[model samples]
Target: MKVFGFAGYSGSGKTTLIERLIPLLRARGLRVSLIKHTHHGFDIDKPGKDSFRFREAGATEVLLAGGQRWALMHELRDEPEPTLDDQLARLAAVDLVLVEGFRTTPIPKIEIHRPAAGHPLLHDKFPNIVAIASDTPLDVQLPQLDLNDPGQIAMFILKSVDLA
Candidate 1:
């Protein structure tokens, strides 16, 4: 699958942009998947649920299935965190994969920037940033995209990965 990523400091609207882009890409008849990496600990299971109980009881993996969807939760426990490639292997094939927050991964990415966020641009430090999506224009060498324009951003992403 063609993989693209978005990198930016928190509050720069990365999630919102991705959320907007998904439908646009899908409307173009391409299948898309997403991988989002977070530094904070998170749980999709709720307390008192069977899946939660299973996990609390030391089950290494717990899968829950319903008519609409299924989710597999694998506890790393003492194991080292899986690499990006390792995680990617678990997904079913798709035309595109939009990754978020794997800033160090060597994938093509767009750096989302909001001047109000007061954070320095990341493309200088992170390699393979093909463009920048910002709320305001900046004096950068990379192609700058309007953060509020999802359709334009979607077109750029497709073109960057040659999906267009």
Candidate 2:
């Protein structure tokens, strides 16, 4: 399966763009999987939840299973985050894998850019960027897109990955 990514600094609309793109990608009948990267200490578990308790109790991993849904939380215990290949191996086969972070990797990516956020364009430094979804045009040879246009942006993503 092919992999595409959204990469940008914090609050550059990366998450928002992916949120809009998922439905459009799914509507095209393509199976999609997502990998979102988070920095620092973030928890999906509640303080008193069993998973939370398990981690606190020195269990390195916790898996909660249910009829309709299941979640597995693994505590690294100071271990490093898994590499991209490691993460990819865990995903089921699909038409595309849309990753939300992992900026320095070699995977092709579309950058979600909000000029007002005042962050430098990642394309300037990262050659992996295939396109830039932005609120304003930049004086670059790369393809430009309006960040508010999810339909168009999603289409660009699909095309960039040759999914179209």
Candidate 3:
């Protein structure tokens, strides 16, 4: 699958943009999947749940299924964190994969930037960042997109990935 990424510091609206972009892309008849990275440890199974109990009992992996959907949780347990490639392999085939985070990975990315967030633009240092989406204009030579305009940003992403 073709892969594109969105990277930014906290509060830059990366998630919001992706949320908006998914339906637009789907409306164009493309299948999309997403892989999001989080620094904080997280769990989908709540404590006292059977899956949680199994995990607490040292199960290596747990699969939860129902009529509507299913999920698989694998335990790293002392293993090094999985690389972006490793995580990507877990996803089912799709036309495109939208990755959020994995900023250090070498991939075509659009950096979501908000000046009020007090974070510097990453495109300056990251050669893989092909565009910038911001709430305000920036002085860079690369393509600058309006952060508030999801339709325009969706077009930018479609063009960037050559799906336009």
Candidate 4:
């Protein structure tokens, strides 16, 4: 699958941009998949759910399947953290994969930035950033898009990945 990525420091608006970009990408007839990296642990299953209990009872992996949907939860208790490539391999199939983190990964990316976030730009350190989406313009030398203008941002992403 063709892959594009978004990276930035905390509060840099990566999630907001991706959330809007997904629908725009779908509108263009591409099957898009998302891989979001989280800094801390998170759980989509309820604490008291049967699957949760099973996992707590020493299940290494759990698959909860139903007529309409299914969920697969794997326990990585002592395993090394999964890298971007590792996670990407899990996707079944898609025309494009949009990643929300892994700024250090080799993937070409769009860096979302907010000056108010008081964080340095990731592109400055990682030249793989092919473009930028920001709340305001910067003096840097890169294609820039208004952060809130999801349409144009989507356009840039689509073109960057050769989808447009």
**Residue 124, candidate 2: C-alpha displacement in angstroms:** 1.6
Count of backbone clashes for each model? Answer: 0, 0, 0, 0
Query: Candidate 1 lDDT, tens digit per residue, 49-97?
Result: 9899999999999999899999999999999988789989999999999
- Range of the 10 consecutive residues with the lowest summed lDDT in candidate 3: 153-162
RMSD of model 4 against the true structure: 1.3
- For TM-score, the strongest prediction is 1
Query: Candidate 3, residues 44-119: lDDT per residue as tens digits?
Result: 8999999999999999999999999999999999999999999889889998899999988999999999999899
Q: List the pairs of residues colliding in candidate 4.
A: none
Cα error, residue 75 of model 1, in Å, equals 0.2
In angstroms, give how far residue 54 of model 1 lies from its true place: 0.6
Error of 2 at 19 (Å): 0.8
Model 1 alpha-carbon miss at residue 138, Å: 0.6
Give candidate 4's whole-model lDDT. Answer: 0.88
Candidate 2 TM-score, C-alpha based: 0.93
Q: lDDT per prediction?
A: 0.94, 0.87, 0.92, 0.88
Worst 10 residues of 2 by lDDT: 154-163
Candidate 2 runs further than 4 Å off: none
Q: How far is candidate 1 from the true structure (C-alpha RMSD, Å)?
A: 0.7
State each model's C-alpha RMSD to the native. Answer: 0.7, 1.3, 0.9, 1.3
Model 4 lDDT per residue over 70-145, tens place: 8889999999999988898999899999998888889999988898888887788998998888887898899888
Find the candidate with the highest lDDT and give its number: 1
Ranking by TM-score: 1, 3, 4, 2
